[model samples]
Target chain A: MPLLAEGSFNLLSVDPGLVFWTVVTFTLVLLVLWRYAWKPIIEALDARNDKIEGDLKKSEDLRKEAEDLLKSYSDKIDSAKHEVNGMLEKARKDAEDLRNKILQTAQEDATIVKDRSKNDIEQAKVKAIREIQELSVDISLKLLGNVLNQDVNDEEHRKIVLRELEKLKSSN
Target chain B: MLSVMNSLALVFALTLAQAPANNQGQIVPLQKVESGVSAKETSVKEDGAEAASADVHESAESFDLNEVINHHLGDVRLRDFYIMGYNFPITKRVAMMWVAMTLLLVILIPAARSISRNAAKRPGRFTSMIEVFVTFIRQDVGENTMGHHSRSYEPFLLTLFFFILFCNLIGLIPPMGEIAVKAGELFGYQFHLEPGDIPLPLKIWSGITPTGDLSVTATLAITSFFIIQISGLVYQGIAYIKNIVPAGIPWIMWPILWPIEVLGQFTKPFALAIRLLANMTAGHMIILVFLGFIFQFQQLAIIPLSISISVAIYLLEIFVALLQAYIFVFLTALFIAGSQHRH
Candidate 1:
């Protein structure tokens, strides 16, 4: 056995010592492996998983932020259009009021000129009628005076001449 | 000469127990071994007819190393009751086996203690490495081998792989470091020391690879073989036996392929066991022999060649220690996987 211990090229055989040791070694190794090795491997994987999830969430948040910024920009554009429209409507209303005031003053001035022109025409017509009536009566009286060879200027003189003429005709 | 005689006698005593030898001296003459060379003559006598020399020659052409190796195991397996006898020495193998076990307990228990639930971070390097290996085995081998109950086998496979790895590594180291033993005991027989009792073999560094022995390897192979068969039987039953021959064989070819398939099953694991033993064992021996050649062939011209060869082989042996461990684990996984398959 001691000679055997001095390792020679021995052929394959079961050394009882070798078998016994193999079993004992196996048991001890199994125990260590259960506790130290497998447990840590699982833990590391789980940790890595958590880290990946957190990264995904951060990306989602950034995406949402981008979306919000886009929405705000669109809303600003919409309100600008509404504001422009309001200003245009106000300007149009102001222009319409100015036009209406000028029309009202023009109508009032036209009415006043028409009234003054009608009053002047009526006054002229009355003056002409009075002149014609006075001229006719003056001519008739002059003719009468020539034919009768009498001159009458006042009302009392005329009345006496007429009475004297009438008495002479009656005696004839 | 006395030492040679004793070695001869030791070898013979172990051989005759297996079978009876005829007048021609070949035991178990029923079958011819793979080589055509007949194992007829055990002893060599120099014949004048063969241009004989006085120096004894070990016949490489005729002898089988396998037979001689098995011969060393003796009658340990034959006895109904477990007894360690004069021919069989239990004391040596047992003591060493226990020492190996103790070493395992001492090393692993504390390493396990360091791992905890509150370990907010991962464990230390060794612990993390172990974890990675466990996960790999669990995913690759365990799930496939054990199915839904893979975790159950995880503990067993992981433990077995490391245990075997550790033992093989230990075998490669010199058991007793520089402390010289003036004398050593063999099966209660006190070996006398002439000042320095160490043999050239033991004094040199040898590590504890147990697969080097046939008995050790055979036992391991046989155990795996039985486990594989039993699992197959339970999982696939008679259909499992049918699948062992593979599906495409013509019914007419069944007779020939049948025995071969049975033999093949045993052969694969046998090869696994022997391969591990041979690779590690041969590497160690090559290194030993090379170093031995250094002094044994003391001529000046041979010195450089011997040292160079020995150094080269030594480097190769270091790689082998790791290689054997991988092979054993891989083969074990393969066998387990094959057995699990039904079709």
Candidate 2:
């Protein structure tokens, strides 16, 4: 039995001594590595990660500041546009008011000149009618004296003027 | 595709049939072992007879396929190496394991020191590659799988990956057994080797790769098993025992379900150990068997063909080495993760 057992390779069985050695070596190596290598290695990797994260955050902050500056500049531009629009509206209103005042003053002066011309024409017509009437009355008196060969007194002259005025009225 | 597979199946069957015939041809002692038979009479069979070529025929008849295959697959303690009169008996498995461990230390310890000194600087190319492996485990396996326990288990998972990867890759390097034999001779110690004759308990399946042996894989799996249980206990305290039977099962079913779940725990590690051992061992065996084809045929014409086929398998074995290492780490992380969440 021993001779046969010593010549074969049994795949299923375990050697306890080998297993013990394997565990011992594995544990020893693990302990040595954990102390000498793995701890610092993990720390260094974490530190690299932290550095990368910090850089990303700084860039993000700078980007946000630039956006804010851009927004403020746009706000200033918007306010300037509003002020220019207000000044343009006010200038347009003032020009409209000045034009209205000029038109109103021209209309008033035209009315005053038309009224004075109308009064002068009326006065001139009245004075010309009076002169014509006196001339006609004198001519009629001279003609009467020549034809009758008689001197006329004041009362007689007045009565003749009144009679002539009354005859003109009766005729109208 | 079915017909093609059928044809390959036929080809494979033909090779299988051819192997035994070739082996029989070498072992039958056809014209070489007759007592009192003259070399001239053996060589004079109505064909081209050369007395000098009878020795060639005798030499070719001794190649035993089973014995050669067994010697390559089987393990034993080779001759001991004596240094300053202190004899050290070294098996091929142990030597290969030492090589793997030494290689990992050489690469990782320096890279680790570089990072520790100036951590702010970016890693160089080789360091970056190592970082890729480390970060892959940290992020993909550890953090993604174990969550809170990721940081705690990172170093262990890293070590397991490097160890297994080195073992698998080192096994692919040829002539390791021959190298052990030569080392024994160099030390002026000659031990009688009964090749292919060592029995089960005395045999140490050797070439390279301790991972190819159950002793190594079982140890690794057992360690993982302990970690799994301990982490579960630590995280859940005594309540972790409640995880033995899943929630929502009836009280009546507890007896049946409890044993099954407990068995399931053990079976997982068993499978883990077997998967790695079988993969590494099978790859090495296939390469050895392919090379054995040259011996089985004993023809110079078939040597090139056998070598080319073995080279193709060699490339696949290299890919498997990396893949199996990743898989081992991945599964260990998965098991650790599973322990954290009981269900």
Candidate 3:
């Protein structure tokens, strides 16, 4: 090695004085700065970070709440629409039932009227036929009694008249 | 090791070669010291004279490579600066330590105030930058390394980082030692400055960086070493010492392993001190050497080359300044963490 200056100029040599001063300076800096600087700054930074995180979490919760509200609203609207459709279906079924009842009542009324008219007509026809048959029998009895001047209530004459009338009715 | 030996040989050869050219016609007055010698003491006295002459010869030269390297690496004495017939004796290392601390105060005091006052608001750019470093050290270095126990040590780690950072950066400012001497020589010739008529740098300070000094770095390492021990004690309590040996090691192997573990403890801090000292010293030495080359060769052709090389090294030194500071703090955290957690 190139020779070094003998006194107070060695690179490896430690000055006790310097060491003492450095320790003092370093210790003082640590103490003063710890109290003044690092503690407050770190606390503030942590607080800010915590605040930011809290805000983010709060926003997330609010978003979830809104989403839930929206879901419920849509569900309400869906159920209302379903209820309206059900009501409309029930109304349509009611109208259809009313129309069927009216048609059934009209058909029954027409059938009952037509049957009564037919029964009335058939009764009138039966009465007219009975009158005609009674008149024919009376005329025949009167003419026979007046012309012959005999007893009209006799059994042989009445039997003959009735038998003739029966033959006539069969031929007609 | 071989390379170091080889480089020493080269330096010796260069010094031997430069001595003759530098000392061509210079003669020392040996008669002044040769008078008071007995016969038995004559040889010893002559040897002393020879040694003194050698020292004179070495000092008389413009610059030697090793001398410049050592000069750059060595501590500055407070004796270099004196005021009004009073000598305030302290090493430049301590003075530079004070400078670094002062710079820290200048930067951090305002930053701390701003951070506190505007706790809710977003920080400004400068405040944000400082916050980034503070948070990084607290969370990344402190928490990541020491976990829950990191809270107690973050301030110390921050101090260490900024202190060494400032020291290294301030050291890289080419020590105005030679320039100041030249300026004083020029002033001596041109005019005289009476008491209190000089600048502070000229009167009160020498251009020295503290982190480059071994004593400062050693103190730091020693402090870190103690902190490591204290942290271990705090976290591990009475069981701290038991952490040194591997848990599953055979009882017989404890004798072998214990010394290694203990040695590891001292070596860690020792390595820390040396790493910082050597890094800061080497960067300064490279810059000094490059600048010294221009003078050593005294050639017009080497001027630009030396300037360019010195500039390059200076840039690298800047990077080294910041990097070495980070490495020192990072390793200190790692060491403290290691001590606490053991495995």
Candidate 4:
């Protein structure tokens, strides 16, 4: 049912009866409830809502911390890779240097052995050449003397002895 | 299949038969007309009146000893009462309102005492339900509207919201209707519960719904309007006038924007009054219509349909009870907020 005053612009026209009791009723009830109901109920409700909001804040903070940790691990992983590469490169360079030093030592040792053998051989050859040539002449002479006794021709024996004496002199 | 249709047919037949019964037993001044016809007249009048005045005059003829209550305050003859007199025959609503308040206190006082009786235990259904409602309004409506910015008004708003709720809820109870009408009755037995076979309005020997009374609603709305503006003025002082005219409007546009802005301020509170008055009044009319059927039919056979409609309406009225309360409080807050806040 439409309860409005029709065709009137008396914008504030209202049924006085409804208004008066509403105020009375409202006042009485408000007084009673203000004392008992309003305080505890509102307090409890605000407390409950505050608790829920607090929990939500904690969850958000935890989520942020987890993201930070995840970022740190990722950064650490990159740096670890760099450090390992640097160590690997240093190890490889040291290995190459050690190998070169070892090779140089072996070459120096080989050179020493070669020079000592050549020196020894040279000394031995210089001392032995004269004596060996003289010895060979004396031995040949003895052999020829034995052959002359058996069948020696005087002229060939003299020529052989003279050639042998000349050859020995030139060798000395 | 014929029976199902017949059953529906049976229901209609019963409704038609019962329709005349509610009207039959009803006594009217015009004897020759017979309730058969005169009752129809009352029904039509009641319906039209319902549609027109609705809850506005619901308590008018129902209030008894109304002059005595108003006499204490001095009614129309007294110039102040005449000019700004309280309407809605304040006696019964005031009394009933008292009763309801006492009842809530009675219920809550023992309840409060008992909360500590079971220390550490949460309150039970009634207590807890009251708690939940109080808390919801406190945080959602009260705090949100006023904020900590104005703690002074928080308690006031909270009070307004619940009081409106109690009035609305008490009005919904069928007995309270009779109680209200009974309180105003001059001739009939005060405690008669549905006296005759025909449904009867509480034989109010005289009076009306206080909230339905326009004078009362206007007083409320106007006072609230004053408070909204004055407080805005006090808080903002001379700047409150700014609410009547927008700050950034072009100088040439003052002619257009000024009136509208000014009218908006008054209308905000006007809407609150009408809204509260309307919601409260509308509920009674709905219940009356549903009850009118039983009297119109005169047959008991329509009980099923009547009961069905009544129950459905009652369930809906419960919501209206709370909704009207919230709307009243919200509008008050909105008007208050608008005036206080810039634009």
Best by TM-score: 3
Chain B TM-score by candidate, in order shown: 0.62, 0.72, 0.73, 0.62
- Alpha-carbon shift of residue A17 in model 1 (angstroms): 6.9
Give a tens-digit lDDT track for model 1, residues A5-97: 322234643556445444444444556555654444444444544756876898898889999988998888888888888888887887777
lDDT of 4: 0.54
Residue B319 CA error for candidate 1 (Å)?
A: 2.3
Q: Estimate each model's TM-score.
A: 0.52, 0.65, 0.67, 0.51
Question: How many steric clashes between backbone atoms does each model show?
Answer: 19, 6, 0, 46
What is candidate 3's fraction of native contacts? 0.46
Tens digit per residue, CA lDDT, model 3, B42-78: 3434445454556543434434566445334555443
Best first by lDDT, ranked:
3, 2, 4, 1
Answer with 1 or 2, whichever has the higher DockQ.
2
Candidate 3 lDDT by residue in tens digits, A51-97: 89999999999999999999999999999999999999999999999
Whole-model Cα lDDT per candidate?
0.51, 0.66, 0.70, 0.54
Off by over 4 Å in 1: A1-9, A13-172, B1-99, B116-120, B140-150, B177-207, B299-305
Model 4, position B223, has a per-residue lDDT of 61
Model 4: lDDT of residue B65: 26
Which lDDT tens digits does candidate 2 get at residues A1-172?
A: 1212222244666655456557766776677667666777788888988988998998899999999999999999999999999999999989888888888888888887888888888888877865666566666666666666665435678577868876997899
Interface RMSD per candidate (angstroms): 9.5, 7.6, 7.7, 11.1
User: Among these predicted structures, which one has the highest lDDT?
Assistant: 3
Which of 2 and 3 is the better model by lDDT? 3
- Which parts of model 3 have CA positions greater than 4 angstroms off? A1-9, A87-172, B1-63, B66-73, B79-88, B174-199, B203-206
Worst 10 residues of 3 chain A by lDDT: A1-10
Evaluation by lDDT, superior candidate among 1 and 2: 2
